[model samples]
Target: MIKIDAMMVCLDLSDIDEKLVAFSRTICERMQVGKVYFVHNIKLYELGDDFREMFGDVDLAQEVEGNINDIVDEQFANKTAYEVLVSEEPNTEVILADLVKRYNIKLTLLGKKMSTKSTGSLGTKLLRILPCSVLVFPETASFNIQKVLVPIDFSDTSVHALRLSKNLSDQLGLQLEIMHVYRLPSQFFPLISEEKAVRKAEEVVKGKFADLQKRHNEIAGIPYTLVRAANKSIAERISLHLEKGRHDLLVLGLKGNNPLPSLSLGSVPTEMYNTDINVPLWLVYSEEVIK
Candidate 1:
């Protein structure tokens, strides 16, 4: 059984449509998370005279506590479930990180509000800094993971993702597909005269991932498809390739860089997440996920 010692839960009315408290309770039961810190952040008025009316004696702190209790009492009154702590931190990362360290959090479960545009990926941003595994809830994510996509870069982190993916696939009887996008410089730089670049790149991708695929069969016990693409723009090329191959879930191992804040919200993962990818993306870093 996976253990969840502490979990940071964020609820914002701006993007949330359903009763977040109810879902929180259900999540606790399903994932077996023991303790959760229910956090409701109220951003200060930021419009220039468009919306600066002060709320009359309306203490958002007290309201957030009441809502949390209501969730416990109304949803799981007889369940005698886990504990929910209350905090008043308004920043998403600050609140979540404080609780994570205070309670020695192992996993975090988060939900997104259906605003016109999301604050990019809160999980991606938090994952860069946080030391725990985070479960990012999409608009509609089901308990059953039927199909899984694992994008390989032949890193230890990629194998770690496969390790987790293999366990999940076993639990849900999922079909996992291995995708390796082979970038061709010919497709990228038409003017450059490195005629052998494309061929060398192809050889490299095949050499890297081909062995990893065989290792999966020999060890973790997973069957997957190897996808190759000759494109320049890694992010856009990935999106197009995903369109060609129908997948329900995307698994990736993030590597390199100190992690620019723009890594997720501005780079490949962000491009895929912001756009209509028709699936959920699961990213794991080598240090975060054990191989």
Candidate 2:
């Protein structure tokens, strides 16, 4: 499990704010988090002279802070220790990085705008920079965790993801499923038939999974699916399986096998982050992977 001593949540005063706040509260309560930081960044362009004149003496930061406080109070009810931060820093990623370091935050919560007319560039950027794990809640996310789907590549990063998902499932009484998407090598594809290639690939994947289960005994008895990437990319296959399985959450690792020291996000994670999967996604990061 990720040691969530302190966590930060980014709010934009949209309809998803309430749901994100409620979800964070539930996580804090269940995980016994120490502190919560609710942050909202105001762009410099929004603080222009015309806006100031129109709003007449209203403190944008205070108003935003007050709004966040109301939601926190309503959802948390003074149970969890939290602070509301409103900044006009213009650079949200910078503000979030500073806050994460200053507060010793181990996890960050972000909302993915699915139905809203907004591109989630900030969330994508932070996934590359933030020195902690991130849980992105989609707009349609419910306040329940009935089932979780984890996509793995048999790397150490993916092993950590599976272990954490297993721990969470055991603690919360939720169902867990593991998915491994495999592809045949193009060079070998021309030499042999597609049917033989698929069988060979599945055999190799099954051996790796057996070894993984043996090493990580916590994931025993947990069901997993091996999918062959026929025409779609590995990320697309996982997304399709997620919808088909009706999984409530999708958990993934930030880094994959043989990742460069400077590369924080993997290719599959990048693709999934941009796609609207209509489910909450949790990107788990081990301590060694945090830059």
Q: Compared with the true structure, what per-residue lDDT tens digits does model 1 show for residues 1-291?
A: 344566655555433414445555655655556676655555444323433455555665676667666665775543424555555544667766766777777655556533465665565567666655555556655444467877666667667777777766665567876666665545556566555765677677767666765776633345444344543555565666666776667766655344454452225554554554545566554444421
Query: How displaced is residue 75 in candidate 1, in Å?
Result: 6.2
Give a tens-digit lDDT track for model 2, residues 13-64: 9898988889998897778688899999989675679887788877778888
The numbered model that scores best in TM-score is 2
Off by over 4 Å in 2: 1-3, 256-262
Segments in model 1 whose C-alpha atoms lie over 4 Å from true places: 15-32, 44-55, 71-80, 113-115, 119-125, 140-144, 187-204, 213-221, 237-246, 256-266, 286-291
Residue pairs with backbone atoms closer than 3 Å in model 1 (clashes)? 15-113, 15-114
What is the model-wide C-alpha lDDT for candidate 2? 0.86
Q: Pick the candidate with the highest lDDT.
A: 2
Note the Cα lDDT for every prediction shown. Answer: 0.58, 0.86
Cα misplacement distance, residue 203 of candidate 1 (Å): 5.3
Span of ten consecutive residues with least summed lDDT in model 1:
43-52
